[model samples]
Target chain A: MTDDIQSRLDSIAPLIVDGSPHAVALGLSLKALTPGRAVMGARYDESLIGDPDTGTLHGGVVTALLDHACGMAAFAGFGAKDTPATLDLRIDYLRPAKPGLDVTAEASCLKSHGLVAFVRATAHDGDPDDPVAIAQAAFMITKASKLAQERARRAYTEGRME
Target chain B: MSQVLIETLMSAPYVARFGVRLERKGNELTGVLPFADHLVGNPLIPALHGGAVGAFLEIVASASLLASQPLQRLPKPIDVAIDYLRPARAQDVYARAVVARSGRRVANVRVEAWQNRIDAPVATLHGHFLITPGQDDTAAD
Candidate 1:
């Protein structure tokens, strides 16, 4: 089952990459993939600075990145086709993230019962032991037909194989 | 228009950069944050970033408390819980907040954001603020 999940995740890499703009804008790229789990990282950029005195990255940007990562993890767990909308997300900020530091998020799907997927993610600047923020999120899977058609159209327009 | 709420938010250095505007109708308070193309979630999708909506909610929640007590000073948010119901479309976002309860030490406020349609809220926020009483009373009215 783990191997199968990994294979399914590999196939959707391009789609995940294309779906996240905040990741792209901040230079956050996929680092690893597996079924129900994904790792994404962003090289710190001065452009993403929120506070100058503390060199803290804006909380909004971090939340966006975590949301996209959690969504991807939920999508991967679905195995076939699904569009997940965030139902709720709660984040706890442990400490301010300094600018010019690379950050990575490890997102894992805790469970998927019926149409709802539960996920948890932790983001760290460098040391995994000390996380900057931790989040728990739930995503609701919608019908796949319309979203599948949209993805097909997008893939074709963007010259990517579906 | 409550001059106190408007002046208070505009005076804040960080809030000023976001270009937040306050609207008042009797006792109700509405805050608007204009859409900037750069803040879009996905350039291709062109939806308002969820994080931006969260920040706007915090500001609106704080401002709403100030508007409710025009004679008192504003409160500082100790914590805020935001639930994103739907993606905010690429358009100007409008937020309205109600002060649920205000006490000497703590205040609870609820804020909701929408575009043109109020029936469907894109996001909702419940914030708890720490009040600093008698701070705004120093101003000469």
Candidate 2:
């Protein structure tokens, strides 16, 4: 059941990128997925740099990726009918990422009940054992009817780009 | 090397007034927020506003970068997501930052904050900054 839902959500995942400028600017892309999991990939770019000496990526960018990844995972877990808003997120930073390395985030839905969902995710440069950061997020699901209307309105207002 | 960066950060009007200080031990940069009664956002709940903590984390991350690159101005915050682990008590706050990945264009940083208790963190920040090149400083702005 969840696997079927994940497949359907995967088809619409590209739609999530349509209206968010932050997603566009950060060069975030959705990669492959398993039944209850999703992976997001972002390359290191100049627009995301913090300091030249340390060559560290800023915390905000990581947060954005984590947030988006978690939200998408929740959407995938809940099927295509619901849109989720983040209620709260908690993160732990284990180590700083060395400069010029590709960063990847893998997120999973822990549980879903009624209109609430729980998710856990990790961000890392290469190794899962040595993750850069880990996060636990909670999301509140909206009604399917409302979400469909909102998506339609958003699509109409934003229109298609040439 | 970090002396000039520390001086510039401490000299900033907002930072100076807030009494933000930094000390480097090895590669780690630790930021200090001196205890001030006025810094407290709420007296009844006695909890610090999340925004205040966010701003402080931003400074720590920026200054840590400046310590290495003294010539560049502070990078603007593209966005910051903060997770409040616990209520910040009325005490000095300490933070440290690591540059996860620094490219020619953008930099990714992760920062953590704690009060007296090191075992428990008060908050964590994941930030993305848009790095401006040295030659195009004025033009980039």
Candidate 3:
């Protein structure tokens, strides 16, 4: 990838992450973004614990993180020009994340074609060797999403709203 | 008897954050996820986040297992495959889980989530969970 493309992706990555309300609710942050790849992090918080007794993070948290990470990878794989919708997602819980530890997901677009992309990602706390979960997902550029993107581009060009 | 168990299961910290609740009629359990601004993934389409919908399905699956039988602890998800049929609109979402098979050590569940009409499910989940049947006293419920 060229420097210009990398810089453009970097600038737009945070917009995608921050624009999502659920991502904000979960405190997800875009750590890095490159062609066909993205790294996202979620801060550890008490309210997100699934088991009060065990203090383990909920499996749903991992699901959401992986979903967002994989989506970002797919978006980048499309050169950050198109936003895709998830078709299906499969996740395997390898183990419980230790209490009081933040988690991160590293996702990469395995392949991309006309309108569909496949992505894989792994979630880990601090050690990449010990993954908490792994996810495989497929994303497609739907008609509704494409129209929405066009409208947003037009709005941006006209400076109607930031 | 099962209602009490369902309440306990829904009281989990993470599940409570999203304000998910289960309504019971006879032996059946229906899950409701009230719409919230924080649940939206695409403000452009203004649709509910796929993650929120997926997590809600998982919660309903576990709750169904708990309502079915007494368990030593909360069921742990082994693996889950979720198919998104439509973009979930920003509104209250409802779901019901059907236990396809419940073995001694593992349970297979299917979940359907919808917003307006039950026939039109926005997403579906097929998953397996690890469960431990209670010894005796726990089974009384």
Residues B20-98, model 3: lDDT tens digits: 9889897798999999999999888878888889999999999999887777778899999999999999899999999
lDDT of 1 at A109: 88
The CAPRI classification for model 1 reads as: acceptable
Expressed as tens digits, the lDDT of each residue in A58-88 for candidate 2 is: 5545666777778778766666556665656
Rank candidates by TM-score, best first: 3, 1, 2
Give lDDT tens digits, candidate 1, residues A23-104.
5555668887777887887667655554444556656556667777787788776653565667777766677676678888
Q: On a 0 to 100 scale, what is the lDDT of residue A75 in model 3? A: 86
Q: Worst 10-residue stretch by lDDT in candidate 3 chain B?
A: B132-141
Fnat of candidate 1: 0.24
- Which is better, 1 or 3, measured by TM-score? 3
DockQ of candidates 1 onward, in order?
0.28, 0.06, 0.80
Chain A: TM-score in each model:
0.86, 0.85, 0.93
Which candidate has the top score in DockQ?
3
**Highest lDDT, which number?**
3
Name the lDDT value of residue B1 in candidate 1. Answer: 26
Query: In candidate 1, how many Å is residue A39 off?
Result: 2.3
Tens digits of lDDT, candidate 3, A1-162: 557768878657657767899999988899988889989998888888887778998888889999999999998888787889999999999998999999999999999899999999999999999999999999999987898778767766787634
